[model samples]
Target: MSGLLQGIRIVELASWTYVPSAGAALSDWGAEVVKIEDTRGGDPCRYLTIGGLDPAQSRVDANFMMELGNHGKRSIGVDIKSERGRDILRRLIERADVFLTNWLPAALERADLSVERIREFNPNVIVARGSGQGSRGPERDRGGFDAASYLARGAVAYALTPPDAEYPVTQTPAFGDLQGGITLAGGIAAALFHRATTGHAPVVDSSLLSQGVWAMAPDIAAADYYGIDRIPVGNAGTAPNPAVNRYRTRDGRWIQLVFLQADRYWKGFCERIGRPDMATDERFVPLANLVANKETATAELRHTFAERDLADWQKILADEPGVWATLASPKEVLSDPQVVANGYLMTVTDAAGREYRTAAAPVQFDETPPPPRRAPEYGEHTEDILLELGFDWDAIIAAKEAGAVL
Candidate 1:
């Protein structure tokens, strides 16, 4: 299928994951996203340090994180602080349908990239801002990363961390940023609809904090209603229902079972475990009996599971009407049969033909996977973009001498 946003134009004045990720998604869906970078070094994410080691230490050659948040977009390096560069941005904004940014409100105003100034160039353009917090608040101008704003402030880390842990669990890299960016992209899509229908261009706001709240809504609601900060989790032996927790297999791998309706699957589960007789035992016969003797039942199940490897259990539960999954590691997921079959990951080839894989946004159109595109090199298309903007070589030379373009 063709891209959903085939002809849409986005001018992105953003760096890092939050706003740039949204630009990537918009570009993925076939928008023309122009990522405006500074004349020096461009986005910092391109040279990201992973776990105190250089990106190449991860054993992947490409700048994968940058590709993750910035692929499928054109890069235009400009010194936005310069008068000539500001004029260049004005020209780009005049032809754009959306102006997207992640700068702090105060910083944007200081840089002359505020909504009011943007409207002076394209009055009908949609202005979208992705921030650490919403535009209005005591900390509006305060800086935030996904770890601080989304996980910590949003209570994600608080809710997910085990009560016995010394510190709250840290979020995986850019986990919240990518999700929030996808959501922001959806908001931009909605804004486009609103503009087309009402001729009233609206300013769209999305934040890491709000995305966290949305993700943890049910947990937040339950915590508030129950007057609790965090709900504790029980292990297999202590779980109220033996079927609702993880158990280790003989091979040291684990499987998670979540049979909420234990009554319906009790006998079938026992049969799959090669212990049909246990289904009729007084200790586990009725659902209530199983709950009363949960520890014993859990022990019995653990013993049974320990008799088999994860592969053996996989075959035993292949067609069973039960809810369970083998715990796959991050590396294992890359070769997961279902993920491969569904095109969840695609190969992205950089300019030098170096290839790496990246996941697609969850949403798809017409069952067609969005084609992956490599991120631009530093100022990859700067001169071509200038030419398209109707600037001559003399102006380019002046901008180059003045350090206006990278």
Candidate 2:
């Protein structure tokens, strides 16, 4: 089926994992995404992990970059510092429906690619900006990333580790970056839809800090109501709930059993595990009592869980009313039968004839399923794009020789 964004064109002037991932998601939905990279080094991610290898070959073979953010898009190398490059972008913006970037305010001002400038080129273009904090704030100029956003806005410090643990655990990967990307894509889609009906461009502003706050709204709300400082409970839940903790199985795998309504399912769960007598015990009878003695209840649950393997526990809990459980791991999740049945994994071939698989866009449209297209080669279509922009062949060749295009 054709994609919902089949007719949209996006010019992505963003790099790194965050903003690029947003553009990639749009491309997966059949948008014509042209990722503009500098002719000098292209994206820093291309050479980030390829060490002690030929720069030319390794930079071009940025497998991780391709997997994470370049899928289903074309790449164009241009020296945005040069006049010719800026002119090229201006021409492309005239025909583009969306422009995305994660450059800081100062950087955007320096490049003259600010929202006002872009609007001058294409009045109906949706401009989306993803940043660390926001466009205006005391910390607006401060450098922000997933770590800073997590620490500052997500209240991650409160839940960094178990209260009894010696030290806090730092999260790896760019959670803020990923969340910001997803939020940016959604904002852009909304802006585009609005533009389609109103014939007026809109600015979509998103930040890692805002996204982090959104993810922690539940905890924030709880903290507000109880007037109690939320602390790390580790495997236990924030609320006084004993049934939502993680338990270790016989095979050393952890199973997260989340049964919020223990009063409703405790008896059935006990019968399923051949421990029905425990269901009627005074200490474990009422939900409040169980929560009051959570430590003891957790220990008993852990011991019971350790008596069986994960598969056995899964069998016992499968479709059990009010009891929800799952074995956590990305590897296990990717191979899940439900994921496959829903066509969430897509396979695409690159220019090098290598085939790889990637997850499909999360949102599923009833009438339009997105198509996966190969990412573009570095400046592969530079000449063609410049010519289409009304640049003469002589000027294009001059620009190429001037290191303005690769």
Candidate 3:
């Protein structure tokens, strides 16, 4: 594979999308990632059928959620409650360069997989922990979900919802979780570099709440200093500058114009729409008057935009513009020329020989991405990994019989 992290090995002991997505990212960069799951059921995300399909109706192919976060990783199921299973984990960690987990401190202690204990096996390993809130405080042990900790507690949900709306809008699937995972991956990469240079094993910690706050730092920072609340501007027409709003064309397509400095392109904009006289009109003469009389300006602009279809408007305003773009949906983005040219999406083949489009990692190397590997099945590499760890066939059989390693 043509990737930057070809020689790195990561031992991941986390479940669900949040942490697993990080492993997927590492795998994208060519790291050898081994996912450790419980023998009982493995990760619950594997069976998730959120889009109206029952688990029993699923096929032997990759599920949507599983493919999104678990691609390019090997899985090994083991009962960490047993001493033999714990030893197996220790051996993996000892041979790995990085150890990642999402289990809380208490859970890690109970399983004897704490960072301190992990260092006993590999002193130079980077210990990375992903959490819901943080590792400290009274609610440290409390379980944290993306919706509760990241979206609600971190003020994302409140900030995005309109003040007059009856209910908060639902966020995109695993929105916060994916961002947190990316943050954790960057932290782990930095820690690995630090350890390589200084010979000091680093403990990297990342939280969903922290990532959420950071994402909305501009609003949160303003609130802290000026006591201002985040008020969602539901209708762009309500904005003081009507020019910086969305307008619908005759074909029902929208063009969002963000003309912060409206005066700069006033004459050109009026000329582009075949309304040069409107530029000199007394009511719309100066920018100050336009702001004061935004409702009238919005009405006039809406009427002007509605006179033509989106394609006609695009051709008319090809050269005359401050800042504008066609409003695009997610499906439209998939076929966008820029997105395609930049290689933002990739095609992958599943176990059932079905090809599907999947997103590539955010960054690229040599102007292209590595071809993705399919996600491994449950315990797909358990026996092979045990054998590589110096276990004989009989020893592996004994461990499997004891319900330690699967």
Candidate with maximal TM-score: 1
**Model 2 C-alpha RMSD to native:** 3.3
Positional deviation of residue 361's Cα in model 1 after best superposition, in angstroms: 1.4
Question: lDDT tens string, model 2, 1-406?
Answer: 5477888999998877778889888876768888899998788766555445454663233365456677778778899889888888898899999988878888888899888888899988888888878878887766677777755666765655567666666654555676677778888999988888888788888888788778777777778888866732554333357687777889998777678888888888888877787798778878989888877777788789899998998888886887566766877877889877777777676567666666666777774446756566677778777877788989988998888788
Candidate 3 per-residue C-alpha lDDT over 230-346 given as tens digits, one digit per residue, 9 for 90 to 100: 743644245668888889999999998888888898878988888887788777768898888888888889999999999998898888758999999888988999988877777
Which regions of candidate 3 fall more than 4 Å away from where they truly are? Answer: 51-60, 231-237, 275-289, 314-322
Q: What is the TM-score of each candidate against the true structure?
A: 0.94, 0.90, 0.91
Q: Write the per-residue lDDT of candidate 1 for residues 1-406, one digit (tens) a residue.
A: 6399998999999989988999888887889999999988999998787786665554445787888888889999999899999989999999999999999999999988788888999999999999998999999999889999999999898777766677778877899999999999999999999999999999999999999999888789989899987665653135778888788999999999999998899899998889998888999978889989988998898999999999999999998898999999988989999998877777876556667798777677888878878889889899999999999999998999999998
Candidate 3: the clashing residue pairs are none
Instruction: Give candidate 1's root-mean-square deviation (CA, Å).
Output: 1.9
Candidate scoring better on TM-score of 2 and 3: 3
